[model samples]
Target: MTTSAPEPVAHGVGRVRVPMPPGTGLPFSNAYLIDDGDGRVHVVDPGSPTAEARAVLEAAIGDTEVGSIVITHLHADHAGGAAALRARTGAPVLLHERERDALGRIAIGVVPPDLEAWGVPEDRRPELLAAAVVPTAPAATLADQVVEGALGDAQLLDIPGRRVRVIGTPGHTDGHLCLHDEEADLLFTGDHILPTVNSGLGLGGPTDTNPIADYLASLDRAAELDTGTLRALPGHEDPFTGVRERCAALAAHHLRRTEEVAASSGATVWEVASTLTWTGGWDALAGFTLLSALRQTAQHRELVSRRRGL
Candidate 1:
């Protein structure tokens, strides 16, 4: 369900909640519109591809020149509308270099083959395979198009009123980025640190590093940014303070699971996952949900193994 229209967060910042299609997991994802003091705008994480969402974003943009479409990551709920928005506004879309390549591969039907290796039983394999189907751009012409430019770590964007620096935080996805508004003491954490959800790790494109390890290191990086009182404007939840506490909590949450998976060594990913705790219990998860559980469990096990020299 979409919430109210875009509301101001700061002098030049506003947040809009774009409703996802029913049963998409989240109630609504957020997109941010930033004014450059001039008439130009920089849109962040234009969520979803629905007409309704487009309408909401359009209303928020009003008559401003769209300077750039900046994507925090390439997840469907975050970057699904990039191509469409770019087409309409003629604004260049910017993404992390790794995510650009990952999205391109996804558009061409190159997906991960880790499912079979997870040792899921044959009876449940179909559901997992179905879950792995990622939606690409609406048109074949836009399918291979991800972004027009790349945002590197620590690079400052040329937005109007804000000195926004891109911070590379890989874990949720390799090349995941968070934008820091130093002037405002605000950090735009894109699914890297949420208020409520312990968002699944390694859920993005394939990565060469261990996702759990990367996630922990990313948390540390986030902690260092907490000027003791920095506020965080996350992708899914409302704006929050205590950035250090939130970052520590997210890290501890995963490390606890790492301990659980560590104890279940020598078991297959599916078997180990079946023994761990889930939101609705292990047996209740199926299809993509179950596959996600298994994959994260596998990632945790690998992280533990690497640490212990197993």
Candidate 2:
């Protein structure tokens, strides 16, 4: 497989577009390689764990030492290759503790009753139930991967000449993190805030808190980045400027969903979701995709109800 070469983003930042598995909606996931100018590089979000992608990454680094592997979250598309990369590079792996917890839950798999709660029809239930049992065993899951260090919010990384701050933006996943290069005024936004597409909340795993609420708060947290000269290097799209505007747009997108959910007339989650508009049309969605839509619809309805005391 011929892999694409890394594109230079800035003085030391490089973007590697990792190809996703076939049929996945997106074209590719972006993995950023940060060279600290010390003959060592840090790999951020080593996209999918495919031999081609790994080869491309290995070739890009050449003889440079990979000192650290930082995961923005535990989602397979983003953190899937961390373990493989760590094994090859011997680099210390770091991620938010909460991301580890979510991975743990994924290992356990979703239960049938939990699927039942989504109000899916009996005929459609089996597909979702089957999805709970991840085809590959638990050991292959991202959460089960080794972690050399745990990150905390506002903690400064000791990367040479780089003042990288770990911003805990937990809405896309319970432990999603964004790396802020304070010196360069760059924000490495994993799945938390993408350049396009309203990233789904609670997709990481089941959470104790309302994901919609967490997602909104996370958006506000992302908005704190001073926009004077900030550029966003997102996980899935091209590098973009105007971080503040993008964050606000994400927030407004969710607000519209909340209003739609609140106004929808439905006795069940499925009914409410069917009434609302989906990108591919509600009826066109089926299987796990439909399940995700219903799940998100229910969550937004819950949030709106809580806010209005309805």
Candidate 3:
């Protein structure tokens, strides 16, 4: 439940659904507060970068000391308010070492998708390229959000009475993570396995390994947890049970997508993406939407090729 005062989300976690920029296709981001039972609270996923969003968080924090700022990933919505919060409270922001490295890469700017390589028609190229510069969240600037510490796989938080372990579940991004509270049986799954939507793969910078393969393995790894009782608190949606079922469903969806890509007739990424199903039909995709679709199609095709050893 969304609340200004600290409310129990599970055994020790409190939640605040921080707002996002308009037309972002998402209404709010879940900012979890884990109290250390020692007057300090650890903040996770600080939500969109805005003075309004920061006001909400600062009010929720209310007189309590900030123990640390932990980021699950490097998305603007999740890591946006981090800079301001750290500037205000001097809380050392902690992220996975992989994610920290990714931030360094992002600050230098990432390469845009090769439209010609994807075989996009010359007419559609300008619009797609122009959309790249329009800021989706003008208030949420990511270039300034820096990391002061690195979190490793299975690394425990320094809270005296908690046993929260950071699980490196890289799929949605190159350095995505999920926090598993062994004592409380709660997993703070940050876009790794959402209750409502299937997160895209390899949205981060260029990776040497195949994203589909990495995502599939990550799904299996998350399924290893106790699915019957462990509740997941996602970055967007509300908390839920049935971890195993959710993991299986996500995996099946990806596998089926790979099979569809394998069967589709196409000599290029654009051609195959056109034949695939989209929420508003393939012709409706443009700009960032089109870019994302082509990238995902390319990843699926790579997965099929790897499995066949081609």
Highest lDDT among the candidates is held by which one?
Answer: 3
Model 2, 1-310: lDDT tens digits are 3434479997788998888777667878888888885867888988787787677677666777887889898766787788788888788778887877766676676444365566678898887666533322222455545556588899987688788999999887788899999889999999887777777677666788988789888878888885668888999978888778888888888889889988987878877888998888987887657766777888898897789898
Candidate 3 local Cα displacement, residue 26, angstroms:
1.2
Question: RMSD of model 2, in Å?
Answer: 2.5
Output candidate 3 Cα RMSD. Answer: 2.8
- Model 2: colliding residue pairs: none
- Point out where model 2 deviates above 4 Å: 1-5, 132-140
lDDT digits (tens) for residues 225-283 of candidate 1: 99987888889979889889988888888888888887774467878888787878987
For candidate 1, what is the TM-score?
0.92
State how far residue 250 of model 3 sits from its true place (Å).
Answer: 0.5
Report residue 202 deviation for candidate 1 (angstroms): 1.4
Q: Each candidate's lDDT (Cα)?
A: 0.79, 0.78, 0.81
Off by over 4 Å in 3: 1-3, 130-147
Model 3: weakest 10-residue lDDT segment is: 133-142
lDDT string for model 3 (1-310, tens) is: 2326855787668998888888777888899999897878899998888888888888888877888888888777888788888888888888787776766665566666788998989998898777543322221244354545688998998876899898888877788889998989998998898997888778766666777788889888888986589899999988889988999999999888888899998999989998887778887777767777787899998888888999
